[model samples]
Every structure is written in structure tokens, then in C-alpha cells.
Target: MDPERFQKNAMYVETPEVFDAEKNFDDDGRIKRTGTLTTASAHIITAVIGSGVLSLAWAIAQLGWVAGPAVLLAFSFITYFTSTLLADCYRTPDPVHGKRNYTYSDAVESVLGGNKVKLCGLAQYINLVGVTIGYTITASISMVAVKKSDCFHKHGHQAKCSTSNNPYMILFACMQIVLCQIPNFSKLWWLSILAAVMSFAYSTIGLGLSIAKIAEGAPVRTTLTGVQVGVDVSASDKVWRTFQAIGNIAFAYAYSNVLIEIQDTLKSSPPENKVMKKSSLIGILTTTLFYVLCGCLGYAAFGNDAPGNFLTGFGFYEPFWLIDIANICIAVHLVGAYQVFCQPIFGFVEKWSKEKWSNSEFINAEHEVKLPLCGIYSVNFFRLVWRTAYVIVTAVLAMLFPFFNDFLGLIGSVSFWPLTVYFPIEMYIKQSNMKKFSFTWTWLKILIWVCLIVSLIAAAGSIQGLVQDLRKYKPFQAEQ
Candidate 1:
């Protein structure tokens, strides 16, 4: 009667037609990897160039033109360098070969080999969860912007067209519930490609709109030292915002959390490490160029008063249709990027559940339902319940704290030091076993400590911003 209890263990019931054929498996005894340099590059670009790009102009405004671009480049280099180090740890006993570490946590466990395994998993997954929440807030903001753009077009630019982001956040969570059912990271290639294209579309729109605004030849105040004391902001406000700006820039370059997962999708030949390094270079270079142009042009357009998100922040009032299109692209991009980040969390939970309750049929059972055109699909009670619950929780949290820039800055500041910088550096040092306090080791130590200090200051700034936001705003009542 239920039709659910009938189907079970399709993985083991694989027909001869599907299973008997000679299949390719990598050294890890999984499906043959299909990812190439291009796909990896696409994945990196999709992850790195996200809603965070919308804030770069505001980040640039906090620092001056000279320091802004310089800080962006500095973070870019640091991220790329640490990424390369982390890439080599994908394999053990050797950089190019040895036991394969399928995830970032696996790499940390293999190299560092202590309670650090749990630490890595906790930090990585917590950061991933935080990122998905940030995306929820951001996508909803863009969706609200789209509706407001139409209202502003029909009415005047000064019209009170503001709306709360809660409804859009729910809508975004609904979409993620569907997309999150896609199983695993390998199945996300097409989504990554599409999201990469969307990232470019919106970024180009923002850049073009900024150029148009600059061409209008309106005088806007800008300074080499940006937002000086008393003129544009108080001295303490300037300090807090400058640190928060670094956090925003860090958030823009945050592609490392899922680096090993992405690498695992690659074909084993040519060494995943080597290919990943190339992908890193390509992705970082392209995004950096876009960042420099968009951030600088947007600042020049609006000067010290640049909005946190130029496209949605009403930096350009006419050409409302173009602004709507850009916001649409941002929402679409976040849709895919959200899944890209959350799939890892899903995997971790499923793996833990299976291991913890190995014999529980409820956790391991699968029912196959054949459908028209889409073919047979497996439905698991646990996955449906758990994944939906996770998405709902993130949506609720997003509604609670919808301060976009400050939230992004805090998440970035907290995770950047541990996940991006500290863990990678420590893992590389242990894996390579260069002498303690050697030139390389000493410099790497310095880098990690310096990054830790920077992240702490950035996190403090974001906390201050959040405290300020809370003073005047009510939860679930934010409108822009």
C-alpha cells in the first residue's frame, strides 16, 4: 500500500547490464574522475566570485583607492599561496602520489594526525554552514532589489519602495531544498558552469553601470586616506570599517573550504595538485581583474559614499531595467553557489549517520521511484528530512540576522584565519617536515600569526558593526 517499503538496496541490486561492463575506477576505487582543468576553474570561479563581490566597492570605500586595491591583491596572493599548500596535502607521504585524501578534513587528519581531525571538521563545516546562511541573506536582498527596481522605475527614484527580505529568504530556501537533493559534488559540474557565467554577467553589469555613472561627470568627494575622521565618519568608525573591509575582501577570495572536494572530482591523471594550482591561478587572476575594475570604478562613481552593494544599493537609479537584470543574475548565481557550498555539509552528515548507525535500516534504506523523462530516482527518508531541516534552519537564521555586509565580514573574519590560513599552513609544515624554525617554516609561522591577528581585528570590527545595526533595527523587520 505504501509503495515505499518495496524498493531497497538498489546500489547492491545493480543489474549486470550496468555493473558487468568494464568500468573505470581511480586509485581510491571510485568512479573514474571526469573533471578537467576547465571544470575545476569554473568551480573555483563560481565559489570565489559570489555575492561578496557586491561589497567590494564599499570595502574599497573604507580604505583608499591605493590601499584598497593593494589589500585586495595581498589577500589574493595569500589565498592562492595557501591554496597551493593545501592542494599538495590532498595526497599523503608525497605531494603527487600516496594515499589520497578525499576532503579537507581527510587531508588534515592524514597530515596532522591528532584531535586536529575533529577540529578541522568542526571548523570547516561550521564555516560552510555560516556561508550558506550568508548566501541566503544575500540572495534575498538581490530578489528584493529586483522588485524594488520595478517600483522605482514606475515611480520616482525617491519612492519608498523598500521591502523586507524575509519572504525572498524563504523562497531561496525552497529552491535550495530542491537543488540540494542532487546527491553529491560530482553532479554539480553543469551548475558550477552556469553559475560561473552568471557571476560574470552581474559583475560586468555592475562594472558597466559604474562606468556610466562616472561618465555623467558629477563631482564626488574621494580621498587617498578615505573617510577621514569627522568629515565622513568618526575616528573609531573609520578604524572599525577598515578592518571590516579586510574581512569583506577575505570573504571574496574564500574558495579554499571546498578545494579538496572540488579536486576529488578531477581525473587522477596530471596530478590533481598541479591542475588545481593552475585552476587557482586562472580563477584568482580573472576575479582579481574584475575586482580591481569594479571596485575602483564604483568608488570613483560614488566616492566615499559607495553603497555596500552598488547594484542593489540604488547607486544607479535610471536604467532600472539593467539593474533588475543584474540582480536577477546575482540571485541565480547564488542559487548554484549555495548548493556548491552546502553539498559538503550534506556529505559529512550522511557519512557520519551511516557510520554511527550502520545497521539501522531507517538510515540506510532507499526507495527507487521510476519517473517519466527523468528516469529512476532514489528517495531516502533520512536525506529528505535532514536536508530540508538544514535548509529551513539556515533560512530562519538569515531572517533573524539579515545585516548583510556585517554578517559576511564576521563570517569571513572568523573562518579565514583557521580554515584558510592556519590549518593549511600547519598541515603543510607537518607533511613536509622541514626543520623547525627553518627559513620557510619561520616565515610560514609568521604568515599564519599575522593572519590570525588580522582576522581577530576584522572580527571585532564586524561585531561592532553588528552591535550598531542591532541598536536601531529589529530582527525580521529589515527593509532596503
Candidate 2:
């Protein structure tokens, strides 16, 4: 088959079956379907949950409870409106005819052509890199929390502290990559189910404990005072800021690609199954409820001065068992995120290299050309180096920036804005034909403008937060 033509044809098809098969397996030895709506919903929920849950209260507390819900509502509306717009655009393009599978880059290319697409791609690449870094940082923090807990301490606390470097982190990352390399969708589906269960169990237990502590009259510290202090913003300003911060926090919930992938999976399922929409609704509702409960309980228990250390505040202090459980759950969640992040990079690289190395024409054409001796030519070497580097870099970053919510919100808001809000409205404008713009369309345009403006402001806030964090960096400080 012609390489170009084959590539074009494959764009509409689901990801190669081999890749799907490799990632689907449960801890309990069950196989699940990856392309189904249920799995898609799970992916969306898991992606949103990540390590952000740990610091959500801290962020929300900055604005207080009243402002926090407003922020949440605004972001929720933005997500729903923008997503539906994008989904409509996706539906406009016949899934089978043109390139059915559309990425952020594809959407950009369709609207603005090559130059703008390149810019968008760069932004996406940075966002992905930042996300990977954030994931690793969260994983490392979780690992340290587990190590410092009474469970590990009782085993040999002094010795464990002396050898603080976590080998299990590396081992887990490797295991995740290996699992993802498997090419069976059914297996990947099953694994997601187990992951979903583990995630739920961990979150539920932790949340329940947090709520119990709050009910027992735990004192909550107020980080921001309502009275204006010198250079700091007034309480009212802070409240508005918190409302803006909701838009940032809402970025965690933006998982448009996962939704599209899930939609693709459902295409093959029975038409009678309303699983995709139902699962999405269920997942979002479940996650939102959890978020509100955790946020309220955490604030009530730990206040604004919650410790940076895992499971320390929120009344989990001194309970080695609880800490250990939280740590393990967090680590497992990180592994899940790593799998999701790494899959696309792996697929892209694999496809890019296959043609150059495996094609007969390329081989024959290159026969007389001299290849560099030191450069990478062997796929085995590439895989080894790539996997090793991925783990090491991720681990180091995770340790350095353990404040997962800050990083997740910053990166997610910036990157997701264009994909979830701007591009969709742009596509709608380009494709829609109206003799006169209706009131609804006018309202949508206004909403889109608001999203774009708020997105920029939110991105600025997150960037400012990140900068402040970087300025306060202390080396080798123990996880608080």
C-alpha cells in the first residue's frame, strides 16, 4: 500500500488495535472493552481527579466557600457550552470521509492553516510536557508520603529514611509503560475498570475520614483575612480572584479528547445503548459531588493553612495507616495518568519511524547513503532510551514541584482554553450559515468572548502563582 494513502486512510480508523490490546487489563485478571462509553467516562473522571484533589480546598479557601461555588458554576457552564459546540463541529465532518479523527492540531489547521497549526502544536507540546512534569511531581510526593508513614516507619523507619530514594516509583513507571505497550483494547478496558475502582475506594475513604474530622470540631485556619493588608489584595478582591480561580480549577475537568475517543468506541456498540452520554453525565456528576464534599470538608477540617505534606492535615496526622492508604492510592492514580499521557507520544513516534525504517523504498533509497554511526537507528535502543528518560525526567520533576493542583490548573487552563473554547466557536462561525445571526447564536458568541477573556485572566493568575512558587523554592526540603 502507498504510504501516504495508507496514512490518510488510517486517520479515520480507531487507534491501531495492537496499541489498544496492550493497555487493557485489570489487577483482578479481567478484560474490559476500551472503546466503550463507560471506559471513556472513566478516563475523563480519572484524568480530572489526578493529584489536584489534594489541594482543591486550599485553592477554594482562598476565595471562601461562597465565591468557590460561583467559580465552579461559571466554569461548568463554560465547559458544557464549549464542549457541545466542539462536538457539533466534530459531527459536521463525516467521520468516515475526511480525516475522521481530529486533534487540536487538525482543528487549528482546518481553520487557520499551517502556520497557526504549528503555533498551536507548540503550545500543545508545552502543555503535554508540563502535564507530564506535574504528574511526576505528584507521584513523587505521594511516594514520599507513603515512605514517611507509620507503616514503612514501623518496618524500619530509620533505615527507610536513610535510603529515601524510592525504587518502587521507577519500578511502577516501568510497569505502566510495559502495560501500555500491550495492544489489546479489551485488556486496556479491564485495567481501567480496576484503576477506576481503586481510585474510587481511595477517594471515598480519604473523603470520609476528612468529613469525620470536620464533624468532630476540628479547627479550620483562615489563610486570608477579610481586612485589607498593605500590599495584599482585599478580601473582596480575593473573593473575585477566587471566582476566577474556579475557571482555572475547571480546566482539570476538560477532557475533550477522551470524550472523542469514547465516542469512537461507542460507534461499534449497539445503537440502543445510550451508554456514552449516560456515562459522561454520571462521571461528571459524580466527580462534581465529590469535589464539593472534599472541598468543604477539607476546608472545615484543615483550614487555609493545610500542610503541604500528604494526609497530614485534615485530621489524618499520626494515623500511619490512613496516610499509607492515601499514598498508595495517589501513586496508583499517577500511574493511570502516566499511561494516558504516554500513549499518544508512543503512537506518534511509532508511526513516524515505521515508514522510514520499514519501507522498502526508503531502505533501497538509503542503501548508498552513509548513516551516522552515533545516531539512533535501532528501534530497540530508541525504546530503551525513551522509556528510561521518560521515567527519570518525570520522577525528578514530580519531586521538585509536588504542589500538584497548582501545576495542573496552570497548565490545563492555558492549553485547554483554545481547544475547548476558542477553536470551537471559531469553527461554528466558519461553518454556520445564517441570514441573520439569531439571539441564541449572539448569546453564544458573547459567551465565547467571555470564555476567551476569562481564560486569559485565569492563565495569568496561574502563571503568577507558579512564579511565586518558583521564587520560594527551597532545596531538598522534606515533604510537609
Candidate that scores best on lDDT = 1
Model 1 TM: 0.95
Models 1 onward score TM values of 0.95, 0.75
Per-residue error for 378 in candidate 1, Å, reads 2.5
Best by TM-score: 1
Give the alpha carbon lDDT tens digit for every residue of 297-386 in model 1: 889999999988888788887688888999999999999899889988988888789889978887888877666765666777788889
Give model 1 RMSD, 1 decimal: 3.5
Candidate 1 wrong stretches, greater than 4 Å: 1-17, 20-24
Clashing pairs in 1: none
TM-score of predicted structure 2: 0.75
Candidate 2, which segments miss by more than 4 Å at Cα? Answer: 1-34, 89-92, 95-99, 102-104, 107-116, 151-169, 183-187, 221-244, 269-276, 307-315, 353-392, 396-405, 432-436, 475-480
Report the C-alpha displacement of residue 371, candidate 1, in angstroms.
Answer: 2.9
